[model samples]
Target: METVDEVDAPQVRQCPECGATVSVHARFVSWCAACDWNVDPGAPDPDRGRLAAYRKRLARRYGQQLAEEIERSGQEARRVGPDGSTVLAFGVSLLVHSVSGGLLLAAGLLIIGGWHTRILPVFGIVLLIAVATLLPRPGRLPKGAPVLYRADAPRLFELIDEVGAAVGTTGVHAVALDTAHNAWVSTYGIRNRRVMCLGAGLWEVLSPQERVALLGHELGHFANGDVRSSFVMHGALRTLARWYYFLVPHPLDSLLDLCVNTLVFLPRWAVYGLIVLLDGLTLRASQRAEYLADAGAARAGSTVAAVTLMDRLLIGDAVEAHLRRASMTAPEASGGSRGREAREAAERELWERLAARIGSVPESEYERLRRVSARRGHSVDDTHPPTHLRRRCLASAGPHPARVVCDASRTRSIAAELAPARARLARTVIRYNAD
Candidate 1:
């Protein structure tokens, strides 16, 4: 009654126990509908020696490159004659203003001269409106954002401070925890206040030592002066793009809108090009900053820990995918609390599945992950380099044990502290979605 199916093709297989047909789609594993007998062909055994050698070569080659980048970052940091991206962003902003001003001036002269007076003023107004709309406002976090603050999680705050001090940068103004599976540090408020954001989902999966490495990498941005420059450059470029697109005249608008759109079309097009140019000029520096952060992680934790952190971070993607898939299923007759309980259960399940899979990732699969990451190195607009490069760089730096270590009890306490905030944040999310 047993039958075999080809890999990656939908084929019918007969159950050995009950002789019922079951459709199998995947390659690595298959199952039966009517019987529980294993129909798995199992994954092939990987050559551990070859994988070890291959990774060793990658570490040796890319590690040298990482060392060069570290030197470059240090040299550039010292030489500071206005950051290249800042200069480019400013220059582009000035160019946009100049072009807009020039057009308005010409329109004013035309109005004063009584040549095409009506048309000129209308065109001038459109350009002015475009300029006004495009000016960059200070960035702000979303309204009713779900965040766990310092007062709520003092232990986590202490952990952050301890990690920051060890990494030689302890100027944190605030710390917030969210549901995301990524950690970052950014500036908030008009006064350029620095804040650290840690992901609760990420915390759930990582060991205490790995958390230290994550904190180190994020805090390292401040130490390397990446925060302010990135905020300025990214903000400026985004504003420019906004302004450029705002100038596009819609057909539904009156004829004047079309005419105005025509007048500024070339300049708007030029703005797009300038954004592309700025991206190219700044990409290498951005990638180097990522390497420096990886080095920071290695310095704060062990090289093994840093690399493991990178691998574990990849698992977050899978967790998100599973969550999305689970959301597609029809809900049972569940009320509010029941729905919330169900969601929490799903999250717990996803974390367990992700952790188990990551914990036992084979060498061959790890190699495959590295290749995929390397192939998709930083895109033109990406702020970080490929995961493989980061992993390689951390491996190259060699291992350094963490300066601060925490026990399982400490980690659990932090999670417990976040419980109330997590509930509040969940309510905020539900309210937002309802609205």
Candidate 2:
């Protein structure tokens, strides 16, 4: 007796463009094996705004350039130092910081001399308020996200520490769990303590090894000396953005207001120009850092695991679509109920449904996504290299054995430790979707 799988198996067909054999799956995209015809049927349109379009072009250009350089020079592309562009980025950053400092100094001088001239104090106070508003502060974890310390998640921390050691960085000081479909490492507090934010959506879908690869990639940012992530450079960029926000013209109500806006126009635009220049200068280096981090992912998890991780990232849109669909249908599914009971039911089913959705994705779909990525020059964002380029770089670097393994025992233990955070994130996701 033929089972459903055998009866519904994919049929092989000849490609119209290249006369190559292709498998036509019932529920997945089919493209030419040789010519990539129909690989990206819905080709991405140009980004909406001129600046956004420019950024996309710049990312694609630099991504390809870095890939070519890596191919030509092999290991030389991984070396980190203050290259001319980096030096200039830092110089521009320092100039912005100096302007902030000069304003602070002027405010201090005016306040100190206020006893001799009363009006000086009011102006000093105003300048102080401006400085306060513009001062750059370290990022904070999301207010309602589940924050975990070492005591709370010992096993999870152990896994992260192992990955971090493999990547040659001090491990994260804390972990925060959220409902996002992304994960990132960020610094918080005056001491610059590292915090790794694990998105439950992404975390729940990944295998144990892929989780390690994710950690390796993020920790690699710290190990690889990415200048853009550093305190001084990041703070300077933030300060400049703040300055531009305040200096930019507003709606004019009177002749005096128009005059003031006109007076500040040059300085406002100048600040904007500096922000663009600094961003452009450091962007290439940041993209290089991302490739290096992908290497770190391969090192910590085996090359196969790292490659699969990238494939998983390619399916993020699919995952998001699934989530959206699930969220939208939750009300309909729950006997048309609303509020706490319905949300609780959705929360209970969210992770399981996501896992099933991701697992059900056919092999052909992954292949189609890979081809589409190559055709579209797909990227995570402007800051990172294209996904296809990163995957290719990992493949070219040869197979790497896992330096930090996440065996069944450790995996189970880590899951046990993360149970609370998982539940918290699930509730958050359900509530957010309901709203």
Q: Among these predicted structures, which one has the highest lDDT? A: 2
Q: lDDT by residue for model 1 over 157-206, one digit each (tens)?
A: 88878877877788466767676778777877888777777665576577
TM-score of 2: 0.87
> Candidate 2: lDDT of 152?
93
> Which ranges in model 2 have alpha carbons more than 4 Å from their true place?
1-30, 43-52, 74-77, 112-120, 248-261, 331-345, 432-435
Cα lDDT tens digits for candidate 2, 32-53: 7578888888858466665456
At residue 112, give the lDDT of candidate 1. Answer: 62
Q: What TM-score does each of the candidates earn?
A: 0.67, 0.87
Q: Give the number of colliding residue pairs in candidate 1.
A: 1
For residue 134, model 1's alpha carbon misses the true position, in angstroms, by 3.0
Measured by TM-score, how close is model 1 to the native structure?
0.67
Query: Which portions of model 1 miss their true places by more than 4 Å?
Result: 1-133, 227-231, 247-261, 329-364, 378-381, 423-435
